[model samples]
Target: MLRIIGFLLFASFFSLKGQNVDFEYIDKVYVPTIKSVTFHPQGMGIAAPVSDVEGNIPLLLTFDELTNDVKRFSYKLIHCDFDWRPSELMEMEYINGYPEDNIQQYSFSSKTTLPYVHYELTLPNRGTRWTKSGNYLLIVYEDETEKFPVITKRFVVVNNLVQIEPRLVIPANASLYRTHQELDFVVNHPKLLIRQPAQEIKASVVQNGQWKNAVTGISPFSFRNQQIIFDYQGKIVFPGGKEFRPLDLRTLWQRTGQMADLIRTRTSTEVILFKDKLRGEEPYFQNRDINGRFFIETQDQNNQLAADYAQVVFNLYTVEPIYDKDVFLLGSFNDWSPSPEYRMIFSPEEKGYILKKPMKQGFYDYAFATRAKKEEKLDFMETEGSWYETENEYQIFIYYRPFGARYDEVIGYQVFNSKR
Candidate 1:
């Protein structure tokens, strides 16, 4: 049964190989050496998704190469439709400047045991600027070749043609009331005209800053007063996931918030975190969390471009090893995507699961996520637990496709917090 289920899940992901766009990819790196990758609005952290096509706001792309030597890296942009496939528009139609450019801004790690080169690039600069408001993919590759991209991150550009007002409520379904949160929104398009609310207008909603399970292809059940309403009967529901687990790596010199031990060596520094508890047995408790977002901060330095990196070690103890599922340390550090580096391996000697990986110094919010080979859902039941009152962030995106248009335009974008 598990094998069959696993095969189905694998097939579903790769089925879009020839499709125009893929939204399932959150933040992914093609190579193993690439770490501490981040792509967001210049001053905004990973939580915010506001970018202006007027060149008022630019995205800051940064990543670290573990290799000792520096390499020439280049970047390009792909304007995607609302579905996240490459749009039909050509390069000159969407970009004002050249299509591609080399990343000239970078710095080497300072006063750290792990020698690496950090690269940073601001999007829509003088060399390249966007001309349209829609979904986009920022790809980074070595040298001038576009064959194999080292990193691919998604971002959005909005011109704000419409206004979005969103509301969160307990799901109408009795079975999901305790563990689900539903979204109801209204899109007011005063200037833009939509021919069909059901077919021409499309909406998507994402919860807790993760796009893995975002709800898309939303259709309005009713329209009135020049507004489309998305108050679905039992749709637009999301898991009221528990508050994220916090890790404070701002400073490594001494034992910090959750630091169990800090081992210093001539070549590198390693940090050991205390064991984590399984929350399934306990009642739900509300805690302040960053909703799975990450922010870069260095203790000795203010500029994140030159922040020191560390080899952080994570330990999660279990009474007995569960052989059916795989445990992973999930967060924005790896774009909330599953990878071998963040997987925890069970150890009989310690009676726990352990993982040690190199990460840039920062404050990160993560959780222990378990996935079965054949299962489609990422279960937090045994680790983080589900609760209705867990504060989560939600984003509403509305895209419109005119009758004669070739691509979907982002007519409206808004983000709201459920706790508020």
Candidate 2:
């Protein structure tokens, strides 16, 4: 019975793929060209001219047919739901080639200076409105018939007023510091506080890791230019209470000797293990009876040499194996998938589950989620720092430039103050 259900599920998944349009050059060149192109000040009801060269108007595309004469060349802009599913928000614009038609079109005459194309479109004010601020794609198709190459460009539309900018402060000149050393930096403007209630702040730090919570003893400091002090006196720990550290350019060279040796040895077996040992001895593996292993992996196919995949390995221990157990690995690694990836069986002897996934090479904050009957809990053994629930510090930067100006040639900038 289970086998029959599985086969049906597989067939349904493949059937969905068949419904998609088969535009040969869609993903190859068109997608890249759209992505490489940029638009300024993007948002709802916002319109900005598209340009390839920074200051000038964008060049109209011109295509020459090698074999057959090109007929009825046109384009359309399709807006779908957040998931790109069939949405009421979708709209199509006709790009007519010559002005002779009542429909908008580009005309070429003897006076035409260059062989090019031009198009302009204004999105409708009505229909399903964009509710959330996020990244979206603008798909440009050469022909409404879906026969020619189609291009897609990704853009961000921020609909909300609240903005958050976070920054990390390390010593400007010095790089190396002894393990468990105390460091201090000033948090200026609307002073930053440990994200915890005043009375329970200390207890939270002790229960979680010290690094997870901001250091205490900050009240005496003035809010005008608040000072933040961090004490790494216990052991070297990754920030943001993440289970694994990102192997990016900044920290790649830092992994040395025993750490390097461990990664080299265990990479094929489990590539996500961190080499440097934490100061006090603690059991690294958990969920033994649950039959699971947690680890990290990268998503990038090219540049496997660079840190890309960070995943968790799960080893299930039960004889009457649990089927379809929704195991979620949470850490600073995943954005704390309120819900995350499903488990997969790797090998028979390794009869547990693995959540091997790729991550970009950068520091992240994450945790794990497991279900027992009807309740959910975080793996405290793998968790660090307590959520004090206090206001944290954040930095704000505003960069401005005129329409026909270079990005770096900033006309002005402003910094807003915030506590947390």
**Model 1, CA-based lDDT:** 0.80
lDDT of each: 0.80, 0.28
Best candidate, lDDT: 1
Minimum summed lDDT over a 10-residue window in model 1 is located at: 16-25
lDDT of 2 by residue, 1-420 (tens): 999987986775445333335432111224211211222332311122122112122222222211122234333333222232323321211111221111133322111111222233322112212332222334444543554444433322322222222223332323222111122222222332323222211100111211123232222222122222222323222122212322331133234221222232233222333322221224322111100111222233233223322232333233333343344554422213224343333344644334555332333333333444355543332222312121222211111122342221111111211111
Model 2 alpha-carbon drift over 4 Å, by segment:
1-87, 93-156, 159-261, 265-327, 331-361, 373-386, 389-420
Local lDDT at 18 for model 2: 33
Give per-residue CA lDDT, model 1, range 53-167, as digits (tens): 6978878888899867888888777778877777777676788887778899988877677777888999888899989888888777787344457888878888888899998
The TM-score, computed over Cα atoms with residue i paired to residue i, of candidate 2 is: 0.28
Global CA lDDT of candidate 2, please?
A: 0.28
